[model samples]
Target: MTISRRILLASPVLAMATPASAQGDWPSRTIRIIVPAPGGAGTADNLARIFAQEMEKRLPQRVIIENRGGAAGNVGATAAARAAPDGYTILWTWAGTMATNPAMYSDMPFDPQRDFVPVVLLGSVPNILIVNNDFPAQSLAEFTAYAKANPGAINHGTTGNGSSMHLAAELYGQRSGTRLTHVPYAAPAAATTDLIAGRIQAMFNLVTGAQPLVTGGRARALAVLSPERVPQLPDVPTAAELGMPGLAFGTWFCLMLPRGADPAIVSRLNALANEVLADPEARRRLEGAGMALDGGGTPERLAQYLREEMASHAELVRISGAKVN
Candidate 1:
């Protein structure tokens, strides 16, 4: 049988799967995955590379990642949104691009729901509450008591005003009924530097980024901002476990295709992605980097998750009064 015919027949149940002719020898050439974030050791970039590497092993064609970071992931997201609906180009972005950006930015470049179709939820990483070694608070309880007693005396640093880290901290303060000051930095690295120097008393940074500081003893991890403790920081308790279930928050990465992509391609890509994520090695690598593996079931499930997250983040933006035009 022809390659196209075989792919079409690969799944008999997915009647909506695009016919071979529609996709036109799908994946005939190299595929590009656009990361709507900076090119660095950040979770998004690292995870994208890992996904690409794993995908390469399964697919016949090469998969390449392009970094187009700027404007809180707006630049790359918009580019991906406007790209041809063909499956060749897909977007690999996180909560900032799909959920937070909608509520945080007034002039959003792309409407995530309208512009793209969810392919899979790559994984999630919780933000750990880290404080300088010199800080008196060694645990979440201690920090809460200290902050409540001195309300506003403790200052926390975040990547930016509306960044995920900022929201995580804000959410914590709101739930815990503490009034901590926010000190926005140009980037997490800058914030980390200030944190080590004791310029800021606390921060809720991604575990992947904050792990080194905690491990090196430059900072102390008080708690993880998730329902469950991460394997990377086995000793640290989750916010939920520490009596602040409402403080559960984290950044989740996902893959999406421009809207109107061929159904067959979507199904094929989703299956391939699930296969990659299910690989023990892939899970180990991602988890070691502080990622919580997400069981990527289907495009519809991902879309529902995105919708729920957007609503939650919208509420956060409203309460925090974070806006960027």
Candidate 2:
């Protein structure tokens, strides 16, 4: 056969092999998933580790996590956004970092929509209206009645302005015609500690984080700020069921790739995430930890979810007057 004929035959084969070869070689080294929160029990960090462990089982490469926690998740998000979009580096973050931060802060380092491509929404934890066991109110009715009588006398603790807790309380106040005095804390732990000490009257805490407090008799959940009751706290009725359907709030998390990541890698990781979340053991652990797993949708869904959350949170910020800056 002529050399030209041989080259033509080889061209198509090379094209096909090149893509396969690239996909195979992609994870040649360790893959790192960046958790934009603290490690050692931080929800995002813990969740990231779960996925990383499962991803390692599937991929030939090792999957590791790097916790870059600080500045309300902006520090880590910025780092991930600036990293090369070659799939080796990724960002596993939550609503606070992507949706709330942009609305809260005027000087954000990265644009969530422009700088990252979503892989999937991991899950969410509902914010529960928790109060110290010593507080007078027992139900939403009693709570709102007490707040209305007291006006801004009730001190509600939050991590900071525009945090899930703060905005949730603000939303409740807006809908219920009651008022709360916002007290900011450096972290949720501190706020919870203060609540336990009776230094704060109430807080909108994540169901998982508030579980032990409720069970231990340190605090009690008045209502779960979700449309439906969560498995973590099955006994707690949803705000909707309590006749305040609009008083819903929660934080969702997602896996995101730095912008321009390989489409093949996005698909592969999204598939792996779905598999990991679907695992009986993983699901049990995550659900037990307060997450409602929703891991299988397309990346586009996550992107759309992010947009919707941004708009919602922007309105929350407006109503709550929450400004981190």
Candidate 3:
């Protein structure tokens, strides 16, 4: 038979095996991942880097990260949601963005529940309540006493309303039964600058953002909002250890693709991501940036976790009255 006639005869066999074969080695093209934050060596950026490095080794093509930062991550997320649902474009962002942004703005371009599919849960880190070294309170106990005595007299800086730092400080005040004025900023760097200048008395800052301030001696490390003390900062105690256990919460970043992405493709990407999270060298860089490796489960588990967190954060906002508008 002629070559064309033979190929036509074999077409049925090729079609039957295509689905099974694709599952064996998916991601046959370059993947573009997006970060909904500024371009920097921040915690979330570091995570995207680590994952990209490991994923590039196993996949047929490379993974790239595009930083699209604005409106506290809404811009990038919206862009990712609008991209093709071919599993090539992924969005990796902090859990706070997923949980808090809906409450901040009246309209969002993408629906967190409907537009995306979870890949995995990255590790979590706690925020640090820091003050300029010149401030009087030396410890969590002392700080609480001072704040209680001077309710609303102390002003604290947060990334913005509905940000993790804002909710954290609000939760700290409510749980400790203290009052402090809030001053919101567009970015953490600005808040850090003001905290260093002693314009603000204190701030609930992410460990990554506060590391330089504390090391530079511009800010005092009071208490961390974690269940236990972090290994890196063994000297600093957790808020629970200092009598504010309820203030403890870990901020996390997670990987997600557009909804309706092929299951085979998602599985391939998830496997590579887990391999990345398990790498020791990668883990070190991420941990230094204040993130932990959370390579534990299937996408279903992460989806459930997201739902529960949404409810939990909603209650937190309701009780704290921490609305952005």
Candidate 4:
């Protein structure tokens, strides 16, 4: 054979070997995790920080978290979606950004289903129905009765117009046949402050955020928004046990990479994440923050879970008539 023909035959083998060789040294440089929310004491932010700390130990390179909080987490999510699908930039976001925002916002910058690949679902925590200490009702039953008796008199506070807290409260009202006037706040801390000060009658907040107040006697937890009671609040009844089965709801945190990322990298990240979650100290810290600890399985499982959540949130959005431009 001619020398040129032999060289041509060798080129095909080199081309086939390029991709595998490239994926072998993945994450050699620093990896960035874009958290689509502001840096604060929020559960989502804490979860991101914890996971980053654990992942850096497991991975070869440093993992950094960047808070791009604005437009209801769209700013960061859009940035992540547009990032190169090279596994260097991953999006660590919660339910609002991935599952609920698409249904709540009319104009989303990127489609969650189309632009991202699920890595793993880190954890979840239920919402707790809390009221100011001086509120007349002491339990879920009394609270419902009070709400029904005084139709629009009871005021409920939420993080924002289309936040998970807002939708969960709406679902609670719809299922329990209670009427509540919603008062939206810029942040949950603000709402929490008002709840403790008796400015707002009641609020549905995450267990992680509300647990301290409930334990300190500043606020009272009427019911937990989970199918079964959470361990942190063993005395509190779930919405299902209180005759409001539809009110079972919570927020979940997840990690994802931009679409077209290498499948090998995706699998590696998933395995590493599950490994971090398996650590006893990590699980203790996360669970102490009220997380249910759902370290996800296969990437396909995360995809399916996202789909189910999207559909469920769509119905809630429709019922609550919530929308953002």
Best model per TM-score = 1
Q: What's the lDDT for residue 262 in model 1? A: 81
- Candidate 4 — which residues are off by over 4 angstroms? 1-21
lDDT of 3 by residue, 193-290 (tens): 89888999899888778777777777899987776666666788888788776777657778887776666767776777777777787778777767
Q: Give the TM-score (vs. native) of candidate 3.
A: 0.88
Ranking by lDDT: 1, 2, 4, 3
* Count of clashes, each model: 1, 0, 0, 0
User: RMSD, model 4, all Cα superposed?
Assistant: 10.4
lDDT of 2 by residue, 1-325 (tens): 0001111111110111112224556788888888888889866677678778777888888988998988889999999999887788979888889988999898999999888877877788778999988999999889999999999988999888888888888889989998899999988899999999999989998777888898888998999887678877789998888889888788788888887776777788788888888889878878767787754566766776777778878988998877867
Which pairs of residues have clashing backbones in candidate 1?
A: 18-264
Q: Tell me which residue pairs clash in candidate 4.
A: none
Candidate 3 segments whose C-alpha is farther than 4 A from its true place: 1-22, 320-325
Between prediction 1 and prediction 4, which has the larger lDDT?
1
In angstroms, the error of model 1 at 14 is 12
TM-scores of the models, in the order given: 0.92, 0.90, 0.88, 0.90
Candidate 1 ranges beyond 4 A from true positions: 1-24
- Candidate 2 has an lDDT of 0.81
Model 4's alpha-carbon lDDT is: 0.80
